[model samples]
Target: MSSKRESPLEVFLNRHDDAAWRETLVTLLPAIHEVDRNAAQVWFHFYPLALLRAFQAAEDPARLAQELLMQGSWYLKDQLDASHTFLYGHRFWPEVKRAVVQLAGGVEIPNGRTLAEVVREVARAAAAERKVDESLTIGIAAVGLMALQQVGSEEFRRAPGEVLIDRRHLKRTPEEVLRERAKDEGQGLFGFLRTADRRWTVVWDENADDRRFKALDKQEVASGAQADKRPWHETDARCTVNEGPIPVQCRSASCGTCWVGVLGGADKLSETEWRERKVMPLFGYVETDDPKPLIRLSCQARAEGPVSVVIPPWNGYFGKYLKRVREGTSEEAVASS
Candidate 1:
């Protein structure tokens, strides 16, 4: 049996646990604007290496991160470039790519440079090169470097220049684009009166005009997409069920596939339920007691008003395994005492 060598970048990433990443995110948050800060949070939830590490640490792991279903193409070596298209900073992907590669290729890992410092340095450099605010590219720059750490420099270099965004969008600045995403068209003076049948727009992809679907008052986000009946799978390969923009399996909370990040209008969604609250942490998506957190199970959360959401590329069930691992560790500790 042969074992592959671990890169220094991978080793560096391993040293930081989930708490370290969350702290680094908070450190970077002040530098990033509101929109990209939300994007960064979603990106962190989407590809949590901590979950991957938990799986690896288990004695008899059921599956690896890549083995999870409906995770999209990003986990594959060839799809690395397209991994972060959902981020607002995607417009500056070229710059982010170069910065990640340069960092990944470094032979020496600086002793005092934590993940936050590394992200800041790369983000500042990209922001300077693009002449845009660090807020725009900082999150995506973090996304790129974290991705390189997860996928390894060998695979990261394999997929170069994919650059999936449309050329028309490239002309606009990230600020202009983010503002457009935050824009909400009023439903009129009588909108509140028309409570039962009111329609709200759920912006699935902020960058595209045709990616939105209408949801009636108090309808689940996934339910609205399922009701669209417009053959969404043709446009997005992940939308395999009901031809909806967001991918889903088992309309109930049993499957974690329908998790989404509310980039805007989180207040408009229904509060969290026991099932959703319990499963979110198990799915390793979130660990929040907040009733209407940014991360939500679309199938479980109903939209009370218009919402802007970002669908993750993958989903899995690791809660049971993780729970067992924790219980085993506890038992071992007690026995040792």
Candidate 2:
């Protein structure tokens, strides 16, 4: 809950309940501020904008540089973690930071930069170096700026933005908003994942990961290993198996069957992904307008680690339905015009 137009701090944060914002601050205090008992309670009173004012107040490049780096570092390890699961297996920071380095490579940028500041720097660097698609690049730079800072400093506080961000750094990606809201509302991850445990032990089938009925059309379960073996669809419908029947439909992205909400083990799951984003609307469950929602189709979504999830029964041709609605609106627009 933030506003589009820049306005006073109170006005920018006008929509969302203060309680949730304060709770997030409270939750992040230990990792971010690392303040004392009295100060922790007062941290929410200090908005990111207020911090920005202080950061900008100091004209010292060395001091500002130190602070900005700390801020960037917090964004990666602490703040972003609030929403997106920072995964392993990536050395791609250079590609993302190409422009940021080429220009600022020599000239010093304020290391105490805020999310907004780092983004602006990326934009400037991109313009200087001639690059497009600076958006994701900026995000990577933010992560990098922080990583570099962590190597040097200890104190860092991230003034995270919720959806409809009022300030710069608090600006959140849709995925982040979903995750934050889910955590705040106790709706599990993106209002789907919850703390849980998988009862039945199952092997990882990358191919099967994207299937509604992993237990179906498979010899592993049907193999004549023993009488106890049964298709998990029948045996695990109640969410009791170590490997449950992943909710699915169309055995394709066409239907969002295999859409399972995480119960206890969200970290065990892999990540919200490209294909998952492509098919989410097809299921009619529009948690967020994000391209990828953490709640994913079991068929399309895979878990790198073990995860426990609750499967939803209801399914609809939501993508088609949304298209129809859009078309109808377009017709209405024509008539009105």
Candidate 3:
């Protein structure tokens, strides 16, 4: 099949403004978010149009993502569930409803909301609560952002190689990955980003003078230094943008170790797509290639746009197995199609 004609979501992502789509999402977001309209607009700038359309009506995509993303924190998950409390809430139906319930609780829970409205509400809530700092939880949010960007942007093309044979939740513990990340922080992804810019800052703690993470992304993130820790913070200090050769692996797509999480730049980075089975999560972060996904494998993720993301400490090649199970269980899959 030639594929159903590109959808409105596709058109919207291509900078095409469909009045119906605009009306749909706009109707859902709170008026409060509308005041700072540009911030909400940023989501449109980075969100993938295709994915947004898919999730707007479907609940599983959004729910499964939340389940995976929230895997790291019981407290956060409870908080999320608390958001549901009464009624079936969002557990069993359209993904948009769950999203609407999750982000727009307390206030802004009136009338009808389109996916775009939900998107705007979410961005505003995220901006408002720069406070909740569970790295894992935040990481999940990053992946969601990435999915949006992947669906809407033109950045994604065909997935590169067969690095990821499957897409599923990786069970590695944070500490496990952290230890591994420590070993390669300087030589892997960090090395790549540093070579691109000297002024770049990667902070563990968003607020810190002379934040450690900053210049490290621009230069070598010194290894073997007690000073260089697993999840280090940038001093928030200023520096010169040094340019150098970025050291990388599978600059073709073999190693899953070079993913980074963008903390600040949602607009500057190139858009992403569901490449090689959405490899990031399989590698251990959260698989998603959203233009603005917080987690991205450095080797696969390239940026022409400016964005600041956290570097995931470790990675692996387990996606192939995951893909096999999914394919095997799927009925009518030709057994080996």
The lDDT of each candidate is: 0.75, 0.34, 0.33
Q: Model 2, residue 198: what's the lDDT?
A: 19
How many clashes does each candidate structure show, in the order listed?
2, 28, 50
TM-score of structure candidate 1: 0.85
Q: In angstroms, what RMSD does candidate 2 have relative to the true structure?
A: 20.3
lDDT of 2 by residue, 163-275 (tens): 22224323434344334323322334443353242122222221122322222111222111122323654633532233334433344555444454442334534455655
- Taking every candidate in turn, the Cα RMSD to the unseen true structure, in Å, is 3.9, 20.3, 16.6
Q: Residues 1-337, candidate 3, lDDT per residue (tens digit)?
A: 0133433333333343323433543454343222122222222222323323333333454463343332111221122222111111111112322332344223433444444443454444444454322222222222233332333222212111111111221333434423432333344456555554433333322222233333323232221012334322222111112211122344444454344444444443445555733565454344434455544444444433233333322233433433433455422233435
Better of 2 and 3 by TM-score: 3
Q: TM-scores, in order shown?
A: 0.85, 0.28, 0.31
lDDT of 1 by residue, 43-81 (tens): 787776755555444444443444434255434344576
Better of 2 and 3 by lDDT: 2
Q: Clash pairs of candidate 1? A: 71-313, 71-314
Query: What does the lDDT read for residue 328 in candidate 2?
Result: 54
